[model samples]
Target: MKSVIFSFLLILALPLSMNGNDFKGIKRITANESQNESNSWINFVKLFELSEIPEKSLTQIACDSKYWLWINEKLVVFEGQLKRGPTPNDTYYDEVDIASYLKLGKNKIAILVWYFGKDGFSHKSSGQAGLVFKNDVLHINSDNTWLSRLNKAFEYTSRDYPNYRLSESNVRFDARKESFDWILLEDNLRGFGRAKVLGDAESSPWNKLVKRPIPLWKNSGLKEYKNKINFPFVSKGDTLILTLPYNAQITPYFKIRSDAGKVIDIRTDNYRIGNTLSVRAEYVTSSGLQEYESLGWMNGHQVRYYFPEGVEIMDVKYRETGYDTEFTGSFTCNDAFFNRLWDKALRTLYVTMRDTYMDCPDRERAQWWGDLVNESGEAFYALSPSAASLTQKGMLELINWQRSDGTIYSPVPGMYTSELPGQMLASIGYYGFWNYYMNTGDKETVEKVYNGVKKYLSVWETDEKGILVHREGDWYWGDWGTNIDKQGIFNAFYYLALKGFKNMSELLGYNGEVKKTQEKMDAFKKAFNAQLWKNGEYRSETYTGETDDRTQALAVVAGLADEAKFPEILQKLKTQKFASPYLEKYVLEALFIMGYEEYGLQRMKERYSEMINDPARTTLYELWNIGSGSVNHAWSGGGLTILSQYVCGVYPVEAAWKTIRIRPQMGSLTYAATENTTVNGKFSVEINKSNGKYRIHTLLPQESNAIVMIPVSYKKINLNNHLIWNGKEKRNQWSEYLGIDNGYHTFKIKSGNWNFVAE
Candidate 1:
């Protein structure tokens, strides 16, 4: 009782700053007096005297759109804050630990806030240029005490502007109008004034506050290019071209000596990706030598700088940055095509992650939830556990944007609130929310969005025969290719959403809800067969086009079609090539799920041969043919998940991988090895067949269990050296030999390093 009392007292004594909303009396402050428009930049500086540095000093910062921080004139945060609106009216704040950058005595802090004044598909306009900050330990709060100014040097570029899908605009910086040394000290404070306090933290516009769920970006500080363009090269009226090794999200930097007002236009080859305007910048020279790194990021393989004939380039480089994660997952096999395909898919997945799981970084950097479903699944198999937070953020955002009438929309945090019925169904279905919970074991997140999921699913209804009343909500988009078969595909997706909700209900111990959900699923399945399944394929009466591989694939994956239909569907998939790359993943997965491992691999190779064989391609395209489409699409990287989950066969049998299954389906390959980081720990497996013997090695994390299955072709089985199976009976020791299922010998194993050989 005494200890409990002491713990309660300790909690009461803890600093209020522990919470992101604990801004005390801190106010939203702004510097813009002139009419603030789109693409506005404001610089702020604050000086404080600290007798001695504290052990730890964390700061809470809230801004309208985005910010960059500097402590003692050293770059601390490259970009901070998630795009606002956890809900329609809420805002997000960032908590950054500034202890390492702090020092004793007089210290200076600088911030550059870029307010995206216009609303786009990904950001909501706050209608005011404001910032709120608090650091109780450091005795700092954003108020009238801070000095700020509207930067006149930063202006909208006269060049092409980005389309409405994007929130960012092309920036043009006039070096003569501003002083770069203002960050160092108050060397030039001509236009500076005290910051105007707007109101408290709970003011209008930004009514609610939430902590940022994902980590700040990982900044790869200025790196020189490997493709040498020989520094100090003088230009002669032509554009200077420097190519990065591959497609990347980067900020271009260059230092050059040129005459005043000579404009140097900088952009990437993909400034107009998918034939749509993307982000780029321009640098107007001051007088003599000047250095500038454009804050706006561009994506492409090559960087081009158009100069006016007389500029002498001293050095050129760029900084690469992306979502904070490490490539802990890996896949390799004897086949080079599959290896290269997996590599390209993994690269594409990483670039598509930033503010949200983007459809494509070069095009609209919007969170199309259909794209997010595939991206989240791929993250579990390709990246470390840190990537899971991004998935959580996306799930929350998708649900938070739910409308009152039980409808949901995507490409959110901004203006595009139109519902894409098929995509919305996929977003809340088994592959999106349930897959995330299975891999992450985040029941809290599940609980947070469960009501929203139930609400969205409630909007969907069925006719008298129990077939879903096809909803063409705002957009009836099914896939990017021909022969959509919308009616059949929507039925399959609705069933999938019902199935996922039932599982979630079961996990949450909602017994009544589970039973209710299961009844709906069963009815839907029976009605779907009666209405859509005919002539060995599940094509609806409404669909008159060719049999859609995507619809057939979804029916198989969702278990809506019977086992009798598998052979016919297999034949159709073998001959048809109508599904886009987005739906192709499900087709490949369904083939694997049906035990057509060889055919699954063959289809993968055939479908992705062009992307794999291209010498210049480092990422997958939005479509299979790759004509006038985005080069880096997250939905197209579903192969990354297929390669790791099916080819390597390492998947969670239970939530958070408390139980895992190692069922290697290395079709024709003699050797295959793969590893991926899970919530439990790192799980790896290597399999090879040589000299009439199959060797299997696995590393399972502690406190977990594994179910290992080896092909029945190898009659004699040995574990570590002891003969566990002698072609007839089994001798059990550390492993319990479960009865064979589906032409393989099964064993239940505890977590540890295990090696098995079957000869």
Candidate 2:
């Protein structure tokens, strides 16, 4: 039986050379003759024989939506292709290396394409269906020679589709209509037709093509449900419940035997998180035993399966997948609550990452710039260096989608194009674009985006008093909750924006811009303090609402407030509680920046108690109260940044971590440790504050330097057990000591492991 199958595969295959290098003039092919419909699926297959597999084979593949490729029944690329419109009217392509997957002879390539033929908040529809494949080394190019057909088995579920905010629709697959043997390239593909050829790379609808900016997703193959093994034989009208180890972005898979036409429904616990439409799938079984898995992804802790009256299930599982990134940075401390919060934040950040840095995996996978600003900053201290590429991609998208009038809106490459002034300001401000550059040292990106940032900032006009005349964009969103001091928040953000732009201008040698932005910054600061500073709290004269903690937090964060007023400002933050989880981060950061490290740590724990302590949740929630909001929001994980950078007390002073500051703010905690990776290398530190003494250990990366600071209260300090400081005077081996700064004794050390003790 095996020999007969092998002989049949050889006869239906075509022999091709492994030495073609031409990529031009390859046409886009589709099985559909007329215009393609929304949520369409097409299957393409090619068979070729190779005398010997080459050492290196690379292929470039482009498609309208997304495609999954299989080389000789082995999955090579899963869900390959980025959303359309890097800029308007252009598409992105994937270049995959297939060298290892090719065999010596009788190799087959099968591709399944899922074309999202409609527009949404994160995707732009091309209104056409096509696939183009070119292998310069193996000489395999897709054209009319490839056998193709529309997969009729794949269709929309009978239920309503996901909300218009989502590009993906509810998927339904009928096993009876699909022949699983097609992947083996069986004899006589009767219904398959010659692919209809479209024009070359420069063709319309998909005008210009750019390479995919990020790496393909990391697939965790198939992982069984950890919470349950006895998946009850769900009969018609019965449901099966299973749970994952935690919340994750995953596709569902199961095998079962059922009578024909028995339908089963699959969804996750977060199918309707935030009370918004997510995604689900339906599978119609054929007679006898069969297996099926979905390609669309859904995220949650629990998986639910609803069976109509007459189906028998055998096995069930899921395949977890996410953006290609690793946790090269981590933080842990003496408190279990803080440690648990850090772990949850890390999970939230990872699950929300994919084609973009989404606010959440469900509801809408839109790249809201405000969320991206926080997400990008968190990535620097949590994920590997490759994760920075996503931030770069989002930064470019924001500027590339700029309107002629210098107005920039986010959640782009989709239908909704409204500019939220605060979000837009944050996108280009000190902690947004400038912070990304400071962490990654990508000078080219700063140069490319400077002009756009300048143009957008130029649109604002100030009143005679140098106060910004609040100009509302399409949306005037200050924050989520009420009692928002919009005028005060706008001025603070503008100052930060000017500061970031001025720094960029200096970096790019645009001295004229530097001078202009400095003047603007000076004017704004002068006006803000002169007009908004009343009772030691920053609020506009025209506002008559309650005190705004968010504005005060931004004032401290943007350096618009003086240290002399921190006493009163801190009092206001203590009494006011209007900031949402998103804005609450700024408030906590302000506390850390103001030398109130203990209070900062306490506030973070108190504000995140519900999310951190919930036995059912493994990730943070979109709101502090966790009411009707997304349970997994990356923006809410700002505590991760606070813990690593403040409590662990490790942050970069120079771009790409060339120079770092290790000032451990242990607060009331007795011990803390962290390992953070940068473009240069990994930096790890551990600090123990017990027995009325401080023991500090640090391992600095090569080509990097650290300025370590210990409290001035430590009367005597020793480095490597050698006396370095004796409170009043420096000892003989005190070369590493720098003078005191802001109540701490500082030292500069080079690239090696160093240990210090202070009493």
Candidate 3:
């Protein structure tokens, strides 16, 4: 027997500022009013040379919804998602350090502000389109004093998509209508005048914006993709087809010189583009060279430019999807396709992860709860250490938007918060909040939202069958594929929520309330199975006989399924109908929990064949094909989560990572390796199952307690040729649940590695 092992070093923590509550004196400024509504796109530039680069410089910025603020020529920040303020009238601003992007002298400051008067998920303008900036070192503000013109190349799109009403902007650029050197110091400002300055934030329509305990959006210094594609001039017969090897949200800029008014239409398969003001294939050639820099964002896999028999594009510098923070996690295996799939899933997380967990960066840049639960919610634990707290901020915002009656909405602070009965406001959103709680043991968060959780639970009463019912015409968005199965799915999610609430109740010392919840849960579980379970699987509706894979997935995770029925439910999912990538995210997770690791891995390979085999795809798509309008959807990145929970099997046993569960189930692969960093510390694992025996090498940060569960009977196993009786073998859904007894085997042994050779 060994002693308790504690070897990890304490990680240094960095403090971050939250949303702003005070902005009394800063004036809101906009483009000169004479030009207001004159063009959809406004280009503003101010040239200033620094005598000597300052030791430090910070800039304050605010815009309608979308703005590209560049310090010098380098693209500094392409902030797309912003809330008005925490409240109804607050305007939001960002403070960024510009010292690194600036030189000693001769620097250019440029801004391309896109005013989508027609509200979209990412933006809802207060009618007046504007930009504001102020920096003591390099004094600046968004006012009429800056040179500006409405560039006609960027045109507002059809905005035809459903969930987000995606602004499918068309780009038809005529260089002749362009502003030359718009981002250069040499651009003439003689025509520039006073910008129609709005009153300071306090007096403006957007008076106060959310000042979070932790800001959601931070500059990760987005880096260009390793592979950059440049194409030569081409005409109508030969349209330039440019596709990314993966999915990302990027600002695609190009240089072109064409005869005045030569039409070129740009077409895109992705639902959202960085710049919607311009046509993707429509290029109106100006007499001279005009550089087109899209302030808007485009997220997709393939884009093309069609020249009208003559218009020519000089060259295009296309950047891949943008992401913040540094990637600290890694995953690899013996299978090459699996590795590629892992890479694509990781990219999906990166592209869809902005200020919050976007459902899909390509279309709706809104932070969705169920989507977060499936994808960005867990991936945050891996790559986004700096922004992971953003998830908590998002959770608070959901509760912040909770109505007095306890009903919640989908997109927070939108034109209509109570659009439909989405799963987010009901039960799924809290499921994600629990995940956040487990990863980062923040009691304040639980305390902050406890009342809201209670109120929300009591908002809707259960039917005679004990299923939570929604209002007539209420849209139940459990999973896109769970059509009309709201009853079954919602209850499953409610059960999951109750379990989390019960855990929180104990943690927060609300025993009396938890007991009532437990009683209700006990009753609901019995009623749900009786009402919904039919044909061996749960029906989505009471008498409609509808069934979806998501219903079963949620049932398994939510504890609504009977222990005896696990085998039948697991078999049904293997041969079920298809679902969107977002829905599949949960389905895969359910399989992992049931110890169907091999089937899940095999299903992932067969389902994600396109993403892995297609050379055009650089990231995972939201659907099997580009038809769904999103190539890189956050919800589709379930593989990364699966790898973490099932393959690497390192999960939090308590709030934060005080104690963890290490249950590695290497499916078909002979070897699996992964590393992740949590608030607790870094955890790394490597496993090799060769010659019918297993060898596991593990690393855990300081004083961490763990329940390391693996297969193999205790009687037949020997640790380094020594018989060990510390772990108890139990049979559950898995072949064997190796109960990890922290009291026994400790990492106090040298190297913290162990071997279990078959005796």
The candidate scoring highest on TM-score is 1
- Write down the TM-score for model 1: 0.96
Report backbone clashes per prediction: 0, 2, 57
Give the TM-score of each candidate. 0.96, 0.95, 0.82
lDDT of 3 at 569: 81
Q: By TM-score, how accurate is candidate 3?
A: 0.82
Better of 1 and 3 by TM-score: 1
Least well predicted 10-residue stretch by lDDT in candidate 2: 11-20
Report RMSD (Å) for each prediction in the order shown: 3.9, 6.7, 6.1
Whole-structure CA lDDT of model 1: 0.85
Q: In model 1, which runs have C-alpha deviations exceeding 4 angstroms?
A: 1-19, 32-34, 186-188
Please estimate how well model 3 matches the true structure, expressed as its whole-model Cα lDDT. Answer: 0.61
> What's the C-alpha lDDT at position 90 in model 3?
50
Q: lDDT tens string, model 3, 594-622?
A: 77888888888887888779776677766
Predicted candidate 2 versus true structure: per-residue lDDT over 161-189, tens digit per residue: 68889999888999888855677755466
Return the lDDT, model 1, position 494: 89
